[model samples]
Target chain A: MGLLSLLSGLCRWNNNDEENSAARSFILSSVLWLAFVVSLALILATKFVWPDFLGGTAWLSFGRLRPLHVNGALFGWLSMSSTGIMLYILPRLTGVRLYSERLGNLTCLLWNLLLIGASITLPLGYTQGREYAEFILPLDYLFMSILALLGYNVFKTVARMKDKAMYVSLWYFLGSLVWMPFTYMVGNNFLMDTTGLGGRGPVPGVNDAMLNWWYGHNIIGMWFSTLGLGIFYYFLPVLTKNPLYSHRLSLIGFWTLAFFYVWNGQHHLIYGPGPDWLEDVAITFSVLMLIPVFAVVYNFFKTAQGSWHLMFDNSPEHLPVRFFMIGGLAYFLTCTQGPFQALKAVNSNLHLSYWVVAHAHLAFLATFSFISMASIYYVLPRLLNTSINLRLAHWHFWLLCLGLIIFLGILHTAGIVQGAMWLVKLEEYDFVTGSALFKPAVEFIDIVRLLHPFYFTLWLGAGLMATGVMLFVVNVLLTFYKADSPGGRLRSKGA
Target chain B: MYTALILFILAGSIICLGGIYYKRSIVLGILVPGAMLLIIIAFLSTAVLPYMEKIPATDKGVPYSERALLGRQIYVREGCWYCHTQQVRPIRTDAGLGNVSQPGDYQYDYPHVLGTERTGPDLSHLGGKYEDDWHRNHLMNPRPKTPEEEGMAGKVKGSVMPPFSYLSREETEALVTYLQSLR
Candidate 1:
């Protein structure tokens, strides 16, 4: 009788009113960080246009602040919020409460601490000095530990799932966790001999470069892309009230993505110093990446076939759907740009130029960030059982879209001009004359001067984006105040 | 290295099989194993094989001196590599930067600083391009401090490279040493 009772208790459905405090806390914290980091980014943009805006402060200097800004946006904002979304979605899809809300909340606490540690240490000139892998050794260990715990929590929850059929979203979430720890370990040069091998740190020389980009691009491909895509899959079905386009298509996309994205790192080294075959592998796989990207995008569009018109509805309740559609379009564009730029002909001119920076933002800010915003807006109200202000949500959407369009437009133009101007200085030889050839062109300095106007406008667009984020934070906080009343539940339900 | 790869595949397969047996889910078994194989193969082809390749240093490739090493640390700490790329390609745009780089050229760069952007300029062959005094002043203020300083590569009017005047003299010297040692 005791054993039977225990089994029955385990299988019991959680009350609909059960407080999901872990997801709620994580979403709130992520919003605050988003506001903070966007403000930091706006400052960075200002410094680009006016270099002397905040000159002479060591901590506030561009180099130090640059790393902090990147880490903040990536780990602080995106990773934390994605984890929150995953935790929330896991229980709903699996038909059980999270295995341990206590552990989930603990993960959130530790993640915030890790970000705080990075914020303090990176600005204080303590870092490992690699891009995207700059956190000190101790922080790396802390992050990995937290990740392991989170993975265990997720797997435990999935093990007890009431539903027998595994969802596509679950595949992405689980696969992402499996890939991340190894990717982080190898990329950060952890768990290896640090002082051996020519004393150039773990994984020496050009191999370190290969390892770095492998880690770097995969952090995007494996972690962020997977998580964001999973969230996209979850929200698409929920918002549109449609079944997934095809289960087979989703699996094909996942497998192809896992295979091809890993081979793409060396494309960053094209025309540089890696072996020829390595570069060829990178290029070929990078192009092949289109298969998975197209598959996922097609699945998304097909699922939203009848619901496409719903995106035009700007009501507060409908904002999440709009965000998802626009974000989906941005994902398609970002992936198309990825394969296009990976080509050697385009890469030779555009590599190490502002074009790449534009591409990074298109992926991070426009695609994943937008998808994240949609997830947060959709999930937060449902978790809180309170509705947010419609006007504020509208403002947030339009302002951010306008700002991103302006910001990306200026950057793309600047990159092309920069590339063409650099090419004008290229040394040419005429075989007929058997002598050096030269052509008149504007100086590199002249090009820098010409870009000043564009940089100023870029800063302005960033300011607008920052304002939109601040409004979002305000609306979310206001929702919390309204959460306590019985009327709040009714309002949300009515919406 | 080979043992490590074999061990990883073995361990991963066991784990997947265990999960499959416990959950009775063949999909998890297949999917997890497939992902494991693909990532390992990718890692082997890109990182492990490259690390094991035998490439002797070119004539221009040499190890760093102790001071230059210290400078490399300072260069990294200040994140100068964020703006400046260290590799010169054979493309037309990089025609006059220097000799096109080789795999052996980076034999001593443990944590390679082949940066991904040219917000400033490529620094692959920046060594001896200008006087030490020019470097000092340029580091102090990337923009020209005087008319004579105008029209230089990084000292142009609108250059956005941040001033490193906050760095101690020793740190600055070490960083400059590292920069000058690049060639």
Candidate 2:
């Protein structure tokens, strides 16, 4: 029985139900990557407090590890898990199996290989030097091709749907599929250094800066957020066991988000060299982004009206719903902060500070990552026909929540201090000018010193988050392997 | 410039509205095309339009030398730009950094490395800030050499910069050259 179960788990493609096969493979792959990358992040957090922790190792240095951490978290953990959710959700919504389970498995295999390649290459100092779009050219091409395959698999399934009426989640999933490939191409392979695409060179000068941010922000807006929203929309009614609050509101949120998000990327350059008019345009759209944010939050709360007790409940059945509730709250805070920080006055102070880092974590970690966790919990048990340990689930949830709060709080406080220190002017003697100069009241190095304690605390928070994620991973593995054991098996009604 | 931008936005909005109105299917017909149009409008305005704008002639802007170009590649490979920013803004935090960065100054910077974060100080005007030896030594050991030194005097205090002593001498020289060429 052990050997048979192991084989069944490993060779999911051989399973008769193709959608379940593909989804289980993708989820399994995603959890392993999450474990690996979260460890990498903890290492990095420790290095911030103790720079010489892994001294003299080139691959282990902060620079190489930073990109690895970012790419691993973004592509490895988040994107793969999203693909799993999409694959799982699409068949049920459309009332048709995936077009090719074999193709889906192939994409999953290739995606893992791509991340493995990144781990090796990035550590070896091979990179394009772009943030969020940092994979080397060949890897970039591989990623695009893999994305295309995933799109083809899902789109063909959508085309063959028996149900003519599409759910709001289907709209979001399909839209993200269409947007992701183009966004990846423009951001990673094409715009900068057209040599890869058979063109002259990069977009001239600061224009490349504008293009980079446009790609960076849109990847989050178009791909990550869209995918997460699709999962959020689908699971909200499922876990809550309630009809959607308003279909019209979901549509409004979708369209408005698609409209305003692409325009708000340049707000990253608020007080920089980009033209003042461009900044103004970004700021305007950024504030307008509130419409979609409010729409999504309102829909979530209204639909979750009577089910709020489930979020507070400690039952294993309520774990998935709990994840969504916290994710919704984080989503509200993150979106509010997004428009607020995009303003010229706020950005000037917080632009490059750890405040921006905190904002990013709030959006990506607290919001989207939480949503992905919710979807996984909702889908995985049903797929495996097993139950997660309630005690373990509760520990996982609270640890992650507490860890992120502490981590973000320290980063925000340190960021404000860093920003203020940089702005504090003090009159000082200048040897070069032979006169008094208006020097910063706190030297840059002094500020770095002041943040050391915060970095250490941040590491502690990261450690807790990592511990929680590991527990989640362990719980998942237990479900797969020890299904007959106590607190392990669940006879879910449907797949 | 503003006129061109305003006209472009108006035209794009009209086309999007018309397309959505005509083709009302929620999936492929409206959502996909609507998204495509919005991204196109954004790409044209933010990236392509800026590329078409003329760079004003200035003595401050100079193309990278052959060795300097090689150094730039080395710098990129090592991911130095992850911590250090190359662009200086007109904002108060950037007061003592350097001259406010202009578009013209980066005319030859292909795939411009106007980095987002500043774990280290801005390197926009670092060309003549220190000697070649100083940079080499600094890269070898970014922390203070002697216990006596503090702040930005002979050594930077409280620096979390990782030592690059593992880099080959040639790569180190190239990276130093790239840092010096930032001016």
Candidate 3:
């Protein structure tokens, strides 16, 4: 009953003209939760180097803790934060108030409930045994409902738009909303038994893999990537005081991305048992993705042509712009690396190595997380009606950047070395003779040992990144409370 | 190939032009139907059609028993797939990992566990590679045994795998059963 009253109180806002209190609260909570989970995940990652750091606990074992970390970061952190940002942006873009802030607040509450449930359930060993789609059936249903609620709210707002022309960001936002629920259903095989559909039994093994990757890649591509790009489109112009360069280019990028990314999932199974043609199709589409990537890259860079100087202004107001610029550059690099790695030769060496891990981080952390941070910075001041601490924000940005570079640099090197050694070892063994190709100069254990120093480097980088996240959280909290104080109330930019 | 490409182009065209050309029905007519069709086609080609072609006449190998299935659950619970890949590719680097994985080999997998990493070696053909006793010893402590121990010589000396000694005996046994059933 107390919980119910608290939730009702949260939804009851006094001033509801333009400021989205519910959305702002959701974004703040999501960012804080993200920081917490990311720190825990990184600490758990250190167990790789120091196995016995906290090894004895059953629930705290690397296996259970790792999934919690992955799911927590993906769903709890990135997805929730993205949804909160979308809520804030949608009303402003449409030039209308949100359809229902009360509904939005309720959704936020339920979303947090689901996240908490997942954090508890996953550690307790209840899972469906799928990466990214690991949440059991019940939780999956809850997520679908959340998506439906969000989609309803956003579409309702769009329906009441004061502006007739659909902006590029709105298009991407709409596409993501359409894409995510279906992708989740297909990837998780949720519709199979319920509809009594044809091919209703469990998805065949190889085919399940294909379906999983399709869902996995599209989640990143359609949901996070598109949403991040949409946020970028909205914020870039606002920050730069410049119009978007080539609106046509933005449309082309969106279309190409939607068409191509779904097919790229099979690239993950390149040398696995999938049909040759399927692999070829995946590779072809992955390479074709270069079109959209280059278009988006050109659009962003050209838009920032004159406004690049703002990034160097060293003002708190410009810090978010700096993040957007750096994230845009990282997005460009990540896409380039993605297509290159999708090639069979490169994949053979890098597929299962730490190279893929590095790529995932570059996409998830460097590109999307950075963009989300910028969005928060851009929107937070407007929502709170006050500025953040410039000094602390600067510290957050540099520390994160430095940490990512070190982490990626070390992992990529380790992956290449491991891949090369594996190849050499394989070549030495004669398949027909079933004997040593040559007396192996080093064993696989030697390769494992070789990676220890790199793992230590990763730990150090993660520590630095965690510190940066804490600083960001603290700065945001202090600014928030300071603005809420009685003395600061006089300066409040209230609706 | 042509069909897939045409479908791809059609999907892209609908997504791009749907909102701009016909704003009235964009959400219900174009966006919903177009996205749904794309998903259907993707599933048809990649999953359903592939299954029709690849379904085995009879089960391959022994089906995972209840115990092994429970062990598989433990594997998933622990996130073992994060480091250890279950699929062996047909490349030189995968030569020592045993036979290249086949679709039929994973016939019983509900949510397929053909993992993507090899932080440890491929486990697709791990069955019978070593004794159950060896697995128990290795799981408890990955350090190589002394030369005085039987069959200890020439084994890989150092390993980065964390001990699962904390796992209850039943859990460990079940996990071992699942590992042995992989081949």
Candidate 4:
């Protein structure tokens, strides 16, 4: 019938040029959507300092908006952006055209629509109450479908690859493709309360917590970190114009990451009521994780051995490599800090503090977002066949770097102060009554008040970062516009 | 510690060495399915299996009533868990948090609201910590201008918590009911 033919036509793989263009369009759309959400989230953060700034409105309240921001940035921005990069990269790495450009476009469309649904519903307070897995059941189904479609497209492309040797990046992409959907189902679906549908109900609270964190930590380690690493592995060598230092080291990094990262979730519950063995195992694996971390770090640094000067070259051309190098440093710091914080002595003080917040931002924003930005820069010129505005790129880089430094530094300092204040004890000498006694002093509320300056600093930092993001968006848009116009010549020089 | 270390080594070897040794298809087939099975088994043994055996009856952690459940939903909706942690760790710093949280403490909790941050404070043992009147006043106005206005001056001076005056009376009462039942 007409519908069937139309469906088959949509599933047909277009020519390479059209397929690549489709991939570029998807990535650009994701970037635009994420940029807007991230900015809105940052602006919403200002209300924390001035609590009643937008208090009366139902949708504008902190509670509703915060989750939207978190989920929006995580799912809408990071996940979507990563997917687009994978779509673009996988074909090139495999030396094959995408299996189905229409499927790719459909997936992107559905994914963005799901994000739109989430944006509307989340602010309207329709949530599952789970961190990272906050989207409602319908959205979860949509997400699973998107992943399935993407997985099929990717795996099929790999199957048809003209290249024989599977690159380190392909290994990571394959592993992540398999792991993400399974992880999502386990975390968001099985253990949820379906009592309204006549189910036996959810697992106990402690078990749910364990499962949630299991899903939570892996979402970062397996999905974001894995894909980001793949992108890093792929783009680093290409940008540096050197082969990977050691393919063996890269493989070691990938395999070790897969085995060790799964056991890391329980560390988030270190001092919580989980069995002692669980916490112990998590800590041990966390420490062992340093192997893969170091492996990748060594590989990257060694790969860029002679090209270290490029990191200092601040020209518009060197921007992506510079971002990648800085992101590499942040990744190292995040991984190192991960195991250190997993230690009981450190977790005790830092668990609930802004220290964790700083760590999350370091991993997500500084590491993954930076890599994604680099990948975008690398891809944009090649995709459009034009150079980006160099001055704007420089502006974007400095503003973001400055903003992140201030934000992270202030939060870490505030965390230490808050932890110390919470643990502070006062010695009391009842001289008038001739009794010597010691008691805990310092009201919790007072500690909260003391953090006002740090909170203000956080707001300021977020503002700067938001501005940087806006500039990047504008720059990309202008470049795209210029490329389409007459007399706007594509650079005939080096990539 | 030794067992954990050994397991870590074994896991690393299986995946890394397996990938290096075997063909790509075989490695991919084993890695993904094997990992999925391992995670499920791990969860079953560590968390789910224990709950099946050790969960207690109503005397310890009863199920939420309709109103309290409603309030709990509201709490989740508001993202209160983002700020106020519900699990009190067994540490000196948490000595004032009123009792180390036991596994049984959250038996009735569905999607466990044991939050990760303490932007506010621990709410695990907040039951009966303050009178309902005080809670109502504080939720409406966490920091009031006059001491006489809401009796919050002496109790919570310089508290940075946002006022929840926008919540309807019914929503406030439901939330308070949920908080009071945490014990």
Candidate 5:
């Protein structure tokens, strides 16, 4: 009976008219995660240990490693995880067999390949010279193609849905499917950079800034946040066995965030070389962004109201949901602090400090960790057709949360140290090039910074984070084998 | 101090007002004070403003520092702010770039382009740190710029600053004009 139940959970969702084929989605997901782990090991090794590599090339310096790490986590890990969830999620949400299994398989294969290109070309010194748009232009074209295919499949699935509600996940899924391409095109200058879609001249910095930010911030909002939000909407209620506190609030949070999130990316540029008004606008939205963030977090937390135990020791199936919970909170904290940091006065000091890096990682990795972990918990057991070992799942949860605190805490405190020291220094004629003021800060925070400031501490934090990720990767692999429960079987026909 | 009080209260109130607040965000309500704390910090920011150093009005022409400020404008327009910081910190703090950035140096800075992220190095005190030739080489091809390769000091340090071959000589000169103007 348990075996049959497991099978139904695994294959039934994909094939009634069709077989349990989107199986490639499972392979894609596993391979993507495996690839991410392996690549991360190399990247981290280079940054932490192999102080000298690439035969003394300029591009391989640690200055560039920052972007590489971000790309790996965001594009490599987070993007694939979201796609994997969509394999099951889109079908289940839409209540229909995938429109084309072959197409789905192709898209998954091409998407990972394109990501591979981004990793290779970017590190090999081929890049577009923009922050997020670093992958050379052709790689971007490959990305856009994957998005287009995914869009087609999803639209076809939506057309077939029996459920009229278009559950919020579909709304968000479709939103991502639409918005990212638009964001990419403008940011990548897709037409102009290629076939000359628009006339070019002194590409207005403000215009480019706005466009880059619009795309950058939206990825956080429409892609990762929306997906993360959808996961919360589905899993929180299921785990707690409670009706979502208010679908009304959920809708409000969703749309408000959609508008606000895109604008907030500008906050990253405040006190920058941008104009005064631009900084003002960035600061304003940085503050205004609080609305949607609060809405999502409050609503999610509120849903767990009375069923506090559900949040406690529970089925292994729910650990990822707990991650989403904490991730939602971290998002709120990060966003709240984000606007404050954007303010001119504070920004004057905090702009180039580790504090910003801490926040950036907290915001990105927090949401990434939450959503990715939740996706794994929600789907992996089902994918493997077995219940996860609850104890192992709990270990994964603690390690991740603790590691985040260690990582983020160190960065945040280090950032403050960096910011304060900067402010205390001379800026004009008397200014000498030295880290004197900053030295005391590093010393004061030595317990926190632990050792010398700069690369070592950063590598340490990233190291702990890598360890946590390794733990998670192991747990997911172990789930491939069956648990000794009724939930272990994979066929409803009862072999 | 008020900022501390407000933050404490703000954090405390969030804990106090636990549980669902509907479409009405209790968190944003708390965030209002966070904004207030920012205003307070900005008020205290006057300390840095006074330290901004003025150009000595060069006999060669319109104080090249002003031109450097112009170059900084280009830096901003180009989204260099997205990756690099201009502000330097005080003391031996590990981050304010390797120097204690001075207030006098930024007096003329209208928008104060000190950035927050180290997607690149803090440029608070990049003045006289490089020569025209070195800056040219780095800007033309960051891929080849040596980044001082190793060690703490080099007469002509290597760097990973991107190539600005896209800019004309005048534009590049203007940029160099502005960069050299940095204290």
Candidate 6:
């Protein structure tokens, strides 16, 4: 980790002087957005039409591209934006300068370079075959170092803050940074035999299953939940024109999420070899999982009630914050439903169905989407040093919600049709074909048929969404200015 | 209708949590819990009220009797809903994977497990499809099995299903029994 940071520091453009910090944020955010556009262009090309990049090569197949698409969304778009948000928020929330612009520069450089390496490696067939953990070993060093830098800088900012009482949002932001890398290390089989690094034939399935769920659930429990809650805690109150409803309930939600959330993870394996006791315990925990989700929602929904006036009047606050508010409610819907699905009786039929995919997308993509957008709306202005285009932001939020719901609906129908047929043994469609390499259009015959209509809807919806993002970045550029930033803008001006 | 229910939930939440935010005083904390309970009840009864029970399980040379019903209990406790489901709504065109979940199929269930996801498939009539070997392989990795053999895999062009190789052979056999008993 240390060695990788040293390397990244070499390439970073240092702009952390009090005068240039926001400029640095704008530049880094642009880098992230560029990568996102490229990645999206690549994925949308395959999703709707094939691009020249995927021309005539087995290694550049959809398999490799899929990883690239997902990584680009998560790390390139989401992560880079997270960096931009943190750069602005830390100083404002704490009333201090960021501890080190150099360290911040190091983190950004490593993150982008890692992506450069991945774009090359994934297509060239140097994958670890793990879901999000697919990057090759040498690249992993940069990832670890970035996380360490993130932790170090966050600690310094918090320690040297003007506000003595830590806000809940700060707790969640710092918690996400501290917890995520630790969770990643364990979930990556970082504990496994590190010697097994390259040219591997299909690794053991059980190990993959464990690692996948560990990462999968954490995407919910840690990544989405913590980030979502951070947005909720900060902006929901702002939208509602109220302070938090109950600080006590806020802590209750946090501890409950931390403890019970881990227990409920195995519910993802209800149909597999996850231990029966663990599964049962998870079901118990899953049912209880609703407690925190609703607690979080109630905390916010109640807070936002009086501010309903603000929602219509303040599109900036309303659009981004509403997604999260609605997302919190959806979280309640999904989690409660999740427990019922965990019950063995339900598992007998629903396992591996599209319904599960729908539920997951709802939580990760849709619900967390609200929170992620809220972060953008709240922080992008500060990063770009001007007001964002409210109309574009509103359009982005609605399209995002609509796209996710409809896309998920199509996928849900496809998965259910597949699951239902196998359960009933329908003679008309139940013919089995023998082949190792799949003859496409068979297992997903229904979905393939459904794709004609569904894909158009999904494609159009996502297209509109990407357009909205473009408009936003344009607005960021349109709004760009050098604000006479206050005293808390950088670290040297602080305690 | 969904709007009404949501509006009610939102309103109830406000009345309950109103004092806490405005006055910085905790009052009407009962609202969130009450709203949640009402929603949970509505959801549960929806599952329970619509169940049917006509499934048959064969044991050895003879048809499985009511005792085979115990397998379903094991199924519920195992958290199979996390991966599989037992219901088949109409808009789906995948493969009709559930054993054609019938209204009469869940008569004996205390809580009908008509799950909501298709990470796996519905098991409404999964009474007797595979030999133990086929199931062992399918459970091990759905990818290895031919679509002609099982699932939408052979039928669908591209799919991914991780093998459940972690179940001990004994646990696998018990689960198999439960699956076979689903018909």
- Taking every candidate in turn, the Cα RMSD to the unseen true structure, in Å, is 6.8, 3.7, 4.2, 5.3, 11.0, 13.5
What would the per-residue lDDT of candidate 5 be over residues A446-484, giving only the tens digit for each residue?
222332444455566566666666667656655643542
Chain A only TM-scores, each candidate in turn: 0.91, 0.92, 0.92, 0.91, 0.82, 0.80
Q: On a 0 to 1 TM-score scale, where does candidate 5 land against the true structure?
A: 0.69
Alpha carbon lDDT of each predicted model: 0.80, 0.81, 0.76, 0.78, 0.56, 0.54
Docking class of 4: acceptable
Per-candidate TM-score against the hidden true structure: 0.90, 0.92, 0.90, 0.90, 0.69, 0.64
Best-performing candidate as measured by TM-score: 2
| Colliding residue pairs in candidate 4 | none
**Model 4 lDDT, residue A320, Cα:** 93
Least well predicted 10-residue stretch by lDDT in candidate 5 chain A: A194-203
lDDT by residue for model 4 (A243-315), tens? 8899888877877787778877889998897777778878988998999999999998888889878877877
* Model 4 spans with C-alpha error above 4 angstroms: A1-17, A191-200, A426-440, A484-495, B1-13, B23-60, B145-157
Root mean square deviation (Cα) for candidate 3: 4.2
Candidate 3 per-residue C-alpha lDDT over A1-495 given as tens digits, one digit per residue, 9 for 90 to 100: 433433343344323333586676578667767876876768676887887667767777787777778788888888878888888899888999888886777677778888888888887877666788877777888899988988898888888976567777887788889888888887777644322221123666677788888888878988889888888888878888789998878877776677677777889899887778778878988999999899899998888889989988797778788888888988999999999999999999899999888898889888888888888888878777778988899899889888888988998898898888887752465688897643224576778888889889999888888888778887777666655655553135432
Candidate 6 lDDT over residue span A1-495, tens digit each: 432432232243443344335325534454345446444543543443222233334344444565666666666666666555656666767788888876776577667778888878866656555556666677776777877888788778777875466666675676576566756664555534443222121223232344455565665576557756775677666656688897767755654565455545456656443234445656776777677767786786777767655555654545555655666667666766677777876665565665676676676556665455566666656543456677766775666566566677776675566555545433343346632221123444343344445445655655655565555555444443212123322222431
Q: In model 3, which runs have C-alpha deviations exceeding 4 angstroms?
A: A1-18, A191-201, A426-442, A488-495, B1-36, B56-61, B144-157
lDDT tens per residue, model 2, A1-495: 744654455554434344477887888788888999999999899888888788678899888989999999999999999999899998889888889888888888889899999999998888777789889888998999998999899889988986666888988898898888888888874824443221114556577678778889999999999999999999989988899998877877877787778887789987777777788999998998999899899999999899988889777777898888888899999999999999889999988888988998898899988999988888877887767777888889999988988999998998898888889877667789788556556667778888889988999999999999888887776666765344443213222
- Top-DockQ structure, candidate number: 2
Residue A28 alpha-carbon offset, candidate 4, angstroms: 1.4
Clash totals in order: 0, 0, 2, 0, 52, 79
Model 2 per-residue lDDT at A280? 90
CA shift of A341, model 3, Å: 1.2
Interface RMSD of predicted model 6: 14.9
Worst 10 residues of 2 chain A by lDDT: A191-200
What TM-score does chain B of candidate 2 reach? 0.83
Error of 1 at A310 (Å): 1.3
Model 1: CA > 4 A from native: A1-19, A192-199, A426-442, A484-495, B1-25, B145-155
